[model samples]
Target chain A: MSLPHAILTALLEKPSSGLELTRRFDRSIGYFWSATHQQIYRELGKLEQAGHIRALPAPTPARGQKKEYEVLPAGRAELTEWVARSEDPKPLRSALLLRMRAAAVVGAPGMREELRRHLDLHRRQLEEYRAIEVRDFPPARRESEPDRLRHLVLRGGIDLERFWVEWLTQALGELER
Target chain B: MSLPHAILTALLEKPSSGLELTRRFDRSIGYFWSATHQQIYRELGKLEQAGHIRALPAPTPARGQKKEYEVLPAGRAELTEWVARSEDPKPLRSALLLRMRAAAVVGAPGMREELRRHLDLHRRQLEEYRAIEVRDFPPARRESEPDRLRHLVLRGGIDLERFWVEWLTQALGELER
Candidate 1:
């Protein structure tokens, strides 16, 4: 449900071909809302049919040609309406924590190794987010409304990865003791 | 997927009727993984059919009878295997962050109110976590492995609420500027 609206928002920011949207999702939108390329393409078709979005004329007519898309006025209105609606916060589903709970019951054999694996993964992701932060939102940069908002989203990712690294370390320490 | 495993974990901790399981989920399991009462009943039926769980014979039988469930040895083995498997950490999907992004483009009318509401909600949750920490996890008490694991999960909730409160405060400050 949110995915369609997310796509609409992205297209409103910039008209993009399906391929371009897929790449953008991997780099940006994927940070918060991940979608496989197939899912994105399928949603694009739905949005086009629903009158929320429209495909630009193909430069070359072909069966498998990529098509560009832009949000219609309806899409913008829908996004605006959706923005104003209040949504309840849902608790994030964490597989690691669930495993921890299960490990407590079944005995945490081999779990220490998995916890360490998670630690390494989070560390790499933390570095990746930090590199992005340094590259994109350097000091002295004039921030626009959209830029500031995007930076906040990036901050969410950075903070979350840091939390994981910290918590996983604590877990490992506890497991070893 | 994880829901069944979570149910298994809870059942292993204590055998409970379906209705009891629903209430437990709203309090404890609900912290990390949430499920509606209907989903719980449906999964209970499936789990029974799959031989992972079995319904305990009731002393009295009648319409709308409450059914108790217990995990079988097969269920315990399955949960143990699941606990040891490596799982990829999912990207945290946040509707609030999505709303913030949409607000940046669509104009955030009335969004300040929502942000303030989130702040208060998180504040209350943070306090509740702290209270639990003080009451149950008092440092004077010696801890067992299960106790420590539960505490770690509690810490996850506490840390996450703290993060939200901090981030929301920062976000509100930015909005006011």
Candidate 2:
């Protein structure tokens, strides 16, 4: 449902092919939403069939042929309608916690090790986020309005990672004791 | 894959009826993973049939017949093996960011409103997290080494929410200008 909107949004930012969209998704919006190459290609076909976007005829210099897409007026209208009307909270599905809950049956020791691993992963993520902040925003602009918002989202990611690390440490300690 | 483990873990915490497991999931593990009552019941049946969990005779209850579940030795072994394995990184799937990217098409005005609404929701989440911190951990304990991990996780949630609010304000300003 929202996939069309996501596709349209990506196209709106700039005309792109299914391959390009997948790449862009990884680099930019990938920070928030992700789609597999298969999913992206499938959605692109649907959007084109629906007349939301059209593939522009173009040739690549050295790479395989890439189809460029631009949102049609209809696509723009549909995206607007979706933005205005869609209110359902997107459900989140996580397998990690499921594994943790299941681990409780096996015993506490294994669960502690799993959590320690999770903590390490999160700590690394926080470091990556901090690096993005430093590289993406200039020093003076870091405090500026627009940069602040960008920084804030990155901060959110960092904070969540930090929290996970903290929770793992505490929970692991309790389990050990 | 993790479903079997989660059920075992819940049972380890305490023996529970299928209905009780559903409720416990809503309160604790639901924060990270979610499952419906139907899924819980179905999983329990599978586990019982597979010899991973044993269902005790139904007890006469005030409202209905309750079937309690206890983990079998095999289940414990399976869960331990699972814990030792590494989990793949789950893909991000945030509707908010998808909407924000789409906002690039609707021009600035409508997008600003959406961003503002998101910011408000995050603010409420921040407040909820802060309440959890105060209610769940004592100040002194929060500062301790073990507790510090849990504290960091909570701080992450807080910081993330705060970052969203700040980003909303600045992004809105940028759109206005």
Candidate 3:
């Protein structure tokens, strides 16, 4: 469901080929909603068949022919309806947490070790998020509206990571004792 | 990788049957990792065969039987290894952001509606988080360590959602102009 929505949403911005959608997914959508290249390709075919999108023939620039796609009116209407509807709250899906919950039952020693390891992982994530923020939105270049929006999203990522690290730290401390 | 690890980690906490593991996954691990009951059952069998976990004979109830599983030493070593190592950051996977990025390309009108919709969603999430915090950790219960940790995670969720709504609000304001 999300995959089709993502593709239509992408086309709504502008028409692009399956390949272009894959690239955009990597650079931007991957930040939040990840789809494999295979998944994107598969969905494009499905959407096109459903008439939610139309593929336009592209002239070969040099050696390769690329097909571009645009959201059809039906696609736009579907997307609009989706946007207007309420969404269910999807739960967080982290493997690490599953392990932690099980650890409580396993015994303290092993659980303690696992918690320590998670703490280190969270720390690394916090560092990486910070780096992405600096790389993606250097303060000097954050003057435009889009840049500002990007910065805000980046900040949310950084803050969430920081919180995880802090929680892991505190949890580790408790387990150590 | 995550599936087996999740099962093994849970077993390490305490040996449990597939039924118990599913319940635990719903209550706690559900916050991070989610899996269907079918997946859990399949993985448990795989883990036992792979020598990562062991299934003990079911206690004689003289009627129905359910086998309990414990993580083997090999499993413990694996979990520890995973904890100690740096996890490759999972790609940012967000559907909402993909929509926003696509909106940017499509032109302002549609994008504005998308942003407004997202903002409303985030605002509602923030409220939900607050309600969970209050319900889970009333002021009197806040002094416990576990409660505090739970509260912290909830607070983080609340803050992140709030940040998103605020940013979307501002972004929408500009896009409307």
Candidate 4:
């Protein structure tokens, strides 16, 4: 449900060929709503068939040329409706946490190392988000309404990673004790 | 994979009939790794077939009598191995955040109300976690090793809910501006 809206948003930001959309997902939108290239391509076809988007005319019209797609008015309307829809926050589902609880019953010899590995991963992710903030949303820049919302989304990623980093550190300390 | 392991851990805590197991899942394990009653029952059957767990013999064999299950040595061994297994942290997949990003592209007239609603929900969840912390893991209790590990798991839930409360509050503030 969210993937189609995610694709529509990306298309609205900038019309792109399927390959370009996949690249953008790998870079930006994927941070929040991840989709594989195959999923993206399949969704692209669905959106086209739904008349939510259309392939733009290629200047050269060459065979095997990449087809760029732009969101139709219907797509924008649907995205707007989706944005305002009321949905419950999804419950937490973490295998690591579940494993930790399982370790309480069965002694986990390598569990500490696993926690350390996750701590490192989250720390690196936090640093990456911080770098993006510095590069893209410096305090000096006057942001538009959309920029503000986009920055808020990035902050969500940054804060979530930070939470994991801190929690893992605390868990490691408890394990060591 | 995790569901089966989750069931093993719960059974190890205490041998229980399927009905009791479902209740426990709804109260405690559901916080992290949620499963429907049907899924829990299905997994229980599979575990019994796998010989990782067995139903205790009833004093009187009666039709529709409840069957209690306990983890066998093999199940304990499997759970031990699983706890020590290396698993990558699952990447975050938040539909709410994705919707916010979509809102950035399309004018979201009711988006602020949605953010506020989420903020309220998260705040309530955080409070619930805190109440559980006070009731279950008081400071003066001299916890056993298993208790310590269990408390750590509870802390993970508490911290995670706290993260959502703070992040959602921040998001709502941004939306206000």
* lDDT by residue for model 4 (B1-177), tens: 799999999999999988898899888988899888889889999999999999899898686788899999999988999999999887788998898888777865798888788878878877888888888888755267677888888888887777777887887777777
Residue range A1-177, candidate 2, lDDT tens digits: 767788788888789988889998887666677788899989998999999999886765345677788999999988887766636344345565455444433433455666777778777877887888778866776664435545555555665566566656666765665
- Candidate 1 lDDT, tens digit per residue, A63-175? 78878899998989999988878777877688889889989899999899999998999999899989998998886442676677667767878888888898999999999
Q: Residue by residue across A51-102, what tens digits does model 4's lDDT show?
A: 9999998888775799999999998888888888999988889999999899
Winner by TM-score between candidate 3 and candidate 2: 2
The 0-to-1 C-alpha lDDT of every candidate, in the order given, reads 0.86, 0.70, 0.67, 0.88
**Which candidate, 2 or 4, has the higher DockQ?**
4
Put the candidates in lDDT order, highest first.
4, 1, 2, 3
Q: Against the correct fold, how does model 3 do in TM-score?
A: 0.65
For every candidate, the chain B TM-score is 0.95, 0.73, 0.65, 0.93
Error of 3 at B117 (Å): 12
Model 1 docking grade: medium
Better of 3 and 4 by TM-score: 4
Report DockQ per prediction, comma-separated: 0.72, 0.32, 0.26, 0.80
C-alpha TM-score for every candidate: 0.95, 0.73, 0.65, 0.94
Q: Rank the candidates by DockQ, best first.
A: 4, 1, 2, 3
lDDT of 3 by residue, B1-177 (tens): 677777776676568988899998775454467777899999988887888888786557443478788888898877766544444445556655555454444433456655666777778767877777778788897775545555554554565576677667766665665
**Tens-digit lDDT string for candidate 3 (A1-177):** 678887887777668887888998776555577788899988998999999998775565433467788889998877766644445446556544444444433433455565566667767767876888778778786777656655655655665566667766766765565
Best by TM-score: 1
Q: Which stretches of candidate 1 lie over 4 Å from their true place?
A: none
